[model samples]
Structure formats: structure tokens, C-alpha cells
Target: MRNWTISGTLTVEPAEQRTDLLAEPVAKALAALESPDAGVVEIDPELADTGAFCEAYSSPMSASANCVVVAGKRAGEVRYAAALVLATTRADVNGVIKRRLDVRKASFAPMDEAVELTGMAYGGITPVGLPADWPILIDKAVADSPELVIGSGIRGGKLLVTGELLASLPGAEVIEDLAKPVA
Candidate 1:
């Protein structure tokens, strides 16, 4: 695994070092990657949210990337996608994402629906194991980052990966302004 400059107190090891901490699809996805140079760290499930996780782990908020599932409809067909943005920002679902998805309107997917479709826990949906057809819109800021902490498909842990790796995922697209700075 690559050295993580943003790693916190949580010990980061190879994804295989603790498969028990990864979700089924997340583990499979990492295994399928050509390099799988990511690291995994176990954490308190209750602190999975970005704010809590970063604060408790002594990790900087800017070093965390958050993934949110979005839903839209066009011609009676529902379209699903994920937006990845730095913790310091928020995905522009109503603007950039909606336009990119070619939908009249886009909104965060329902908790139950998102979990059911992605097979990931509600608070732990990473972009790694999304449906093959779903597009993953990554903010340019995230792609330019050296390293970031992202969800591990479950609330109990997180994955440490490089921006280049995430930008190379199956359906990933780097967008210049996919997100807006949080106030």
C-alpha cells in the first residue's frame, strides 16, 4: 500500500490485512483493481461520519472525501450516480450533477434505496463498488489531492487511497466544479 500522509491514529494496513473490516463488494472491487495500492483502517462505526471520524481520529477534514448517492429520472427511467467531494465542500447535485446526468432534477437517493442498490451501509457508501452502470463524478479538487480518507463500504472502517486511483475507477469522471465550498 502507498504511504498515507493523511493517515490518522488508526493504523492503516493493506486492504487484505483486515478483510473483516471491508464490505463484500468493497473487498472484491479492490481485489479486481490492477494495483490495489490502497490501505484500510478499522474505526469506530459510530464515528463513521466524516466530521466525527476526522475529529476523533485527529485527521484533517480536508483530507477526507465524502461520497453521496444521487437519484434522478429521465423519460421514466431512474438514473443513479455518486458524487465524491472533499469534506470541505458539498456536491452540487442540483446544478453540476443534474446537468451531467441529463435529468430534470437530481436529489440524494433515499437511505434505504441507496443501501439496497449499492449493498453498502447507509453511512458507509464508498464509490468503489457501485453498480457498473452508475457514473461516479469526482470533484477536480479530490482528484488533485495526494491522498484522501474515504468510506470502506461499511461504517466500521475507512479506506486510504490516492486521488489518481479513484479517478481511474470504472465510470469515474473528474469534473472541474462538481462541488461547492461549504460555508
Candidate 2:
């Protein structure tokens, strides 16, 4: 099994060593957590989207995860959560996620709001540096993976982490069926 990787033009480095490519919040979060299994790989910014990144870097779709920010309103107060699901599945936004947030309705956060709040590019909002109060609802499959490739909070790179490392993040909650397989 490849614990470290070098694919195409991307060079993987210990996550702690690639602060230059990490967003400020991500850097701070990683520093606070000090997860040793975390790694990072720099890539062309243009290939930041999941399908493109996997194809260009020779990464399997099964090992890629996507983070989506969602918002819900209850009693006129907005609640937000970050959901992590495998690339092959989609978050159960209207069902499981809404129930978890205790809101009558739930939906993807607006692109502009997600980008502004997360301080990351539209396609690169990662769970790593999410606001401290927002829950990180990670699908069980993602938390069970031996290794996962996820956004690095910037389009220029990706973060490589073990399932345990992801689950250990400050508000991460491993939820069963948090996502349903894509039809």
C-alpha cells in the first residue's frame, strides 16, 4: 500500500510542511491538531475540481472525498454544517442532514457565502478549517477509508489524510448513512 504518493506532477509532502499551499485557517487548524498522518500534494489550480483532480493525478475516485457546506434555518436562526462524503455519493441534504441540524429545511450554502465564510475557493471549501462551532458530519465510509484525498482549502493543492485523522478533527462526527450512493 502506498502510504506516501507521487503522482503525475504532484508531489506529496507531510501536511505540516506545505503551509505555503494551505489556506490560513487550514494551517491554523492543522497546527492545533498536529495530525501526523496528514499529507499534502500540490496540483495545478485549474484541476481542483474532483473529477479533474482525480483524472489528472491518477487518483481513484473511490479515494476522493468532497466537503459541502450546508445551511438550515430553525426559528429564524441559521445553522450550518460541513458534510464529508465520498465522491461516488451525495450528502443526504434534505433528509439526514436536515434532521441532524434540527431544521425544517436544509440546502447547500450559497456559493458566495461558502467562499466568503470558508475563505477558500468555491470548489475548495474543506472541512479542515470550518468555523469552530459548525459540526463536521463525515460519512462513515469516509471515516472508514484507510486513506482519503480531500480538498486542501485551496485550489492549488489537496490534503491526504487517514480516516482516523479526519475523524479526529475538532468537531468531526462520523455519521452512518450521512450520504446516499449516487443513483
Candidate 3:
């Protein structure tokens, strides 16, 4: 276990760094959560819908929604930003993120760029392991779900938690009108 808590910073690092969710990792985290409410659900990696359902979609699963975190550099300075967009819609990157990052121009960091800097799998990118300075953009839709499955530091696994719980994670912030459903 590689769990760590910042005594003054109010942050927590996992005890062990697992690539994805297995029964063991899930079970351990479930037991560790302050509130153990959401149930475990298995998802297939090959199917985008499955990942979306378990990780981003909210209909099939009671607690699920989309998440997109953008990282990039502007004017020779590095920045990390994220959006917990509902799977139903795509992020309004130009609308919300540009202002949030305080730049006239902004875009989703390349997949390779995000993976390299965040040190988390593309699909597995969660707010948990994110850098302290990163800014998060959470969708209002998440409030509707009882719980939501976000990344678990690994693409193959998910962390099932309540919306409130997810909000409670370190470096997480709730944003209203962050995006609109994709047409």
C-alpha cells in the first residue's frame, strides 16, 4: 500500500500505485473510502461504450459520467487543467477551459502529452493522481448521479464513488455549465 496523506495540505496519495482495477485493488479502496456506497461494476476495455458507461456514461450505470482533463503549455509555461464533462456531451474547451487556464488560446493536450505528464493512462486519468496545481472543471450533471466511476490510476479499472465523494477528492472542484451535450 502506498497511501499517503499530506498532514497540512489535505491531500491523499494511494498506498500502492496499481495500473488498473482488479478485485483486490477495488476491494481495498472500497474498504478504505469514508463512505462505501457505490457497488462494483466490471467494464471491458476494448469497447468505448463500456468504458463510457462505467467511467463516463450515467444512464446504464447509476453513477457514471465523462471526464476530460487537459494539460498543455502556453507562452513557454506549463499548465494542467481538467473537465469532468458528462459522457452525453463533449467539453466546451474553447468556452470554459480557455478562460479557466487564463489564455487566449487553449486546446486539449495531445493524448501522448497528457499521458507523459500526468503519469496516468489515457482512460484511467482521474483527479486522484493529478498534480496539485492542475485546475478541474466538473460538470453539473454529476450532481444528478448517486455515484460516479472515475479513473483509478489505471485504464482497466475504475473507482466507484458518490458524486460528493468524488468532489471530496484532492484537487477536485465543481464547475457549473462547464459543457453541453454533443450533437
Candidate 4:
């Protein structure tokens, strides 16, 4: 399944790539840069053992980019949002996310359900392929980075791009409080 999305370049959007959880961020990215290598694979054996996150592999400043998918209750409506943050710190959902969406309770989407609904593997859900209705939050830190290695709409690879470009994704909403300080 991963191989299906691992194409060199695409001439048209594939239906199987779309999902209710997120938009096809990578496709927009491809159109943005006009370069296919914008998203590439890093299949080093060391990374294979690091689980879904990359913070443990290096400092937050050096880690690959990450985004958090949140399922919450907003305005009496059950909604979903994705927050892009560096793995060094956790997404400040209660303080950052809750306040932005005017929601009372915002929590990380359950792992089992996140993978199932997002249509991506546990560690591979990217901002792309997310539903249009869902709000995507970008941490200031992510926007500050020179480039980010975010998920490439798949589990086996990631897209390395400028933080500013990521912020420009059609439905992305940039916000502060992407994380909490290390205690």
C-alpha cells in the first residue's frame, strides 16, 4: 500500500489518496515547488527503530517535523484538528488549541482511531490528506524552521520542505503555543 503512494511524480490526483481526516498536503506541495523530490524517503535502519516520532533521535531543532491530530468537542460539535509541532515538546492543546477553536475540551485523537480514520499508518499521518473541514494548527516553531520533514501522506516516507511553505497550505492555520516547556 505504501508503494502506491511512493511514485516519482503524479500527473493527476488519485482518489485512493484522499481521506476524511486530512487534505492531500503533499500534492499541493508538489504543485507549489514543481519538484517531485520535495518529498523523499529516508529509510535508514536507525530510523526504523525510533517509532513514529523523531524527537528522540536528536534535539527538537534537529528532529524531523511532526503534526498532531486532535479530536475535540467544539461549540457542541465534535470536530477534528491537526496541529503541526516539533516533537521536542508536546502540543499545548488545552491552552493553544482549545482557545483557538473556541472549544472546551481538545485532546489528542486516540491512536487506534487516528490511524484508522486518517487513512494513514500510526506514525505517518501528515497534514496532507486531511479533511477540508478540519482545522490545521501550525506551531510558531514549525513555521520558524528553515525546512521541515513532514509526513508525505504516507508512512514509509516524508516531505522535506520550508516551514513557510507548510504554513501556506490552503487550510492551515498558524498559531502560537505549539508546545509546553520541558519540565
Candidate 5:
């Protein structure tokens, strides 16, 4: 199942066969999928950030997705969730995400806290291996795309997957207008 739609200077291979490039949780999550038609490609850890990776590999930024961790608090309880949006857009954390988490305030989770909780490297937190209870809000644009380039839970590689695949994750919720186009 190594058929992939995204391309660059990287060699795409079956993710199952390149588990070494994935975070433990991400590898486990993909392994558990009934039809994990995902592909993996190794890269320089320094170029893992969306912009750098896209420019360096000659990949369109629109074909990439970003998974951001958000934190909110209500009644003294902290709630966490992941937001998936196109690289060319920004997640509506203050609007859609805050309401979805039912919190008075929502903000990007701090790097230390996010990495510690997710057990994934900073800048490489994909929605696939999040805590079971954490909702993964995927923007409709991302869900509707045919294919996407997303983090592999580590800075050294990326995963190629379809919108349908991400929408089918354990706690995924595809929502319209979950993100705003960058101006």
C-alpha cells in the first residue's frame, strides 16, 4: 500500500515498514488501522517545520496539514484537544475550538506541556496518537483534500495520508470552518 500522491526529494515507503521514523504511539496507531494506506518518508529533522519542509522539497504548502495542540480550562479542569488545519490556514482556536472544548478560554498549548502529554516531539505532533479522550478537530478543507502531508510524530520524517484516513481516527470530528484562510 505504498501508493502516494505527494512528492519531493524524499522516498516514500509503507509506514508499517518504516516504523522507525514514527513515534511509538503514532506507529501503534497506524498499525491498528484496518486499512492503513499511509506512506512515510525520512527527512532532515531541521526541516520538519511545515514551511521549511515544503519549500525545501518543492511541495505545495496547500498539500500539507498542521496538527496543533490546544489547551483550555473550565471549572478548574484542563481540557486538551488537537486541531488539524491546512498549512495555508490557521485553526480557529478562540472560536470553534474553545466552544467545542466547552472552556472559557483556549490557547495553543505550551511546548513543554504538549510534548510531555503527547509523548511526541515538538513541531511533530500528529493527531493520530493523541490521548484517547482528546478530540481531534479536522477542518473540512483538510478532510476534503485528496491527500495530505502530515507530521509523523517525530521531526525526522513525515507521513502521507488521505483526508479520509485522518477523519477516521479514533476521536476525529470533521468540522466546517474550523479554520480561517490565512490572509
Candidate 6:
């Protein structure tokens, strides 16, 4: 349990308190993972995007994990997955992800579709409350990190969670090389 602190400027709160803006599923998921090591920090909604959040809060880009929703078709059925990768890397969507989904192609889900389906705002979707059937592919590095900053299902806050806890979340799967280094 490393000390998980947002830069001094942000106010930390029990994750449960900020659930008002979370989609129902996300709120429920966060509730289940409530623990001393897991909490939320509220920030300016304007800085919710990963780059801004990290720069504004002075959080290391390596410690921030982005949860991206990807969609593909397999067997004439639409399939979706949530890919978790550190800000320093990119999910291997066209390589590892396409193979995993057994789809001919895979791409980021349409912003509108992702937002509507996850009940989370664009740029604020976290893996915590994704549909049960969706696979949550967490890069090995992210799952091995002692602590990470992730979305709180809304643009107004960020969640602090341990790698172990995140890996234990429902549907989470830690995969080696799930992401490729950004070059």
C-alpha cells in the first residue's frame, strides 16, 4: 500500500462520496472495492483527460492507467472489451486485441456508443463497471504497479487503487505485452 496521494491541490475523499456522477454499475463496483487503500480524489472536470490530469496534478504519466473501450465483430456478433494500459504505452488493439476478440478487426468504440453503453462520459470510462461479459485486458505492467490513478467513471474525479485490487476486479485479466511502448 504505497501512499496514494493526488498532488497537494486536489481533495481526496472516500470513493463512495463521489458516486453521484458515476454510472450505476460503476458506483456499485466501486462500492464493492471500498477499502482504506482505495479512494477517490476530486479535481477540476476540465482536467479529467489523462494528459491534463497528469500535468495538472503532477502525477507521473507512468502511474496513470487509461481504460479504453474497443469494439469488434466476431461470428456476426458485436463484441466489446476494455483495455487498460499505462499512459506511457498504447494498447495493442490491432495485434493482441484483435486476436483475443477473434475478430477480423478491432477499433476504439465510437465515443457516443462507448459513453452510452458504459454510462460514463467520454475520456472517463474506467474498467470497474464495464459490462460483466466484456473482457478487461490489463497490461502486465499496470497490474504490477503498486498504485495507479484511473478514472472514477466521471470527469470530475480520479480513483486511486492498488494494482492487486484492480487486477482482482471482475472480468480483469492481466496479460503480458497487452500494450506496446509508445515510441
Question: What are the clashing pairs of model 4?
Answer: 21-130, 21-131, 22-129, 22-130, 22-131, 23-128, 23-129, 23-130, 24-129, 25-128
lDDT of each: 0.92, 0.88, 0.57, 0.61, 0.93, 0.85
lDDT of 3 at 95: 76
Between which residue pairs do clashes occur in model 6? none
Instruction: List the RMSD of every prediction in angstroms.
Output: 0.8, 1.8, 8.8, 7.4, 0.8, 1.8
lDDT of 1 by residue, 1-183 (tens): 577877778788998778888888988888899977799989999999999999999989999999999999999999999999999999999999999999999999999999999989989999998899999999999999888999999999899988998999999999999999988
Question: How well does candidate 3 score on lDDT at residue 63?
Answer: 40
Ranking by lDDT: 5, 1, 2, 6, 4, 3
Per-residue lDDT value at 118 in model 1: 92
Model 4 residue 180 CA deviation in Å: 2.1
lDDT digits (tens) for residues 66-146 of candidate 6? 999999998899999999999899999999999998999999999999999898888789988888899999999999988
Query: For model 5, what is the C-alpha lDDT against the true structure?
Result: 0.93
Query: Residue by residue across 1-183, what tens digits does model 4's lDDT show?
Result: 123232223222322344222235545545554333343443333342224334333423444567778877856787788988876667888887888767788888999878777766666677765666778788888878775566655554555556776776668877777777546
Q: How many clashes (backbone atoms < 3 Å, residues ≥3 apart in a chain or on different chains) does model 2 have?
A: 0
lDDT of 2 by residue, 38-153 (tens): 78888889999999998988888898999999999999999999999999999999999999999999999999999998988778789998999999999999999988889889
lDDT of 3 at 60: 47
Q: After superposition, how far is residue 30 of candidate 4 from its true place, in Å?
A: 3.9
In order of appearance, the predictions have TM-scores of 0.98, 0.95, 0.70, 0.70, 0.98, 0.93
lDDT of 4: 0.61
Q: Which candidate wins on lDDT? A: 5
lDDT string for model 3 (59-139, tens) is 344344666767555788867787776566677788777778877677878888777766766776665556567776777
User: Between candidates 1 and 3, which one is better according to TM-score?
Assistant: 1
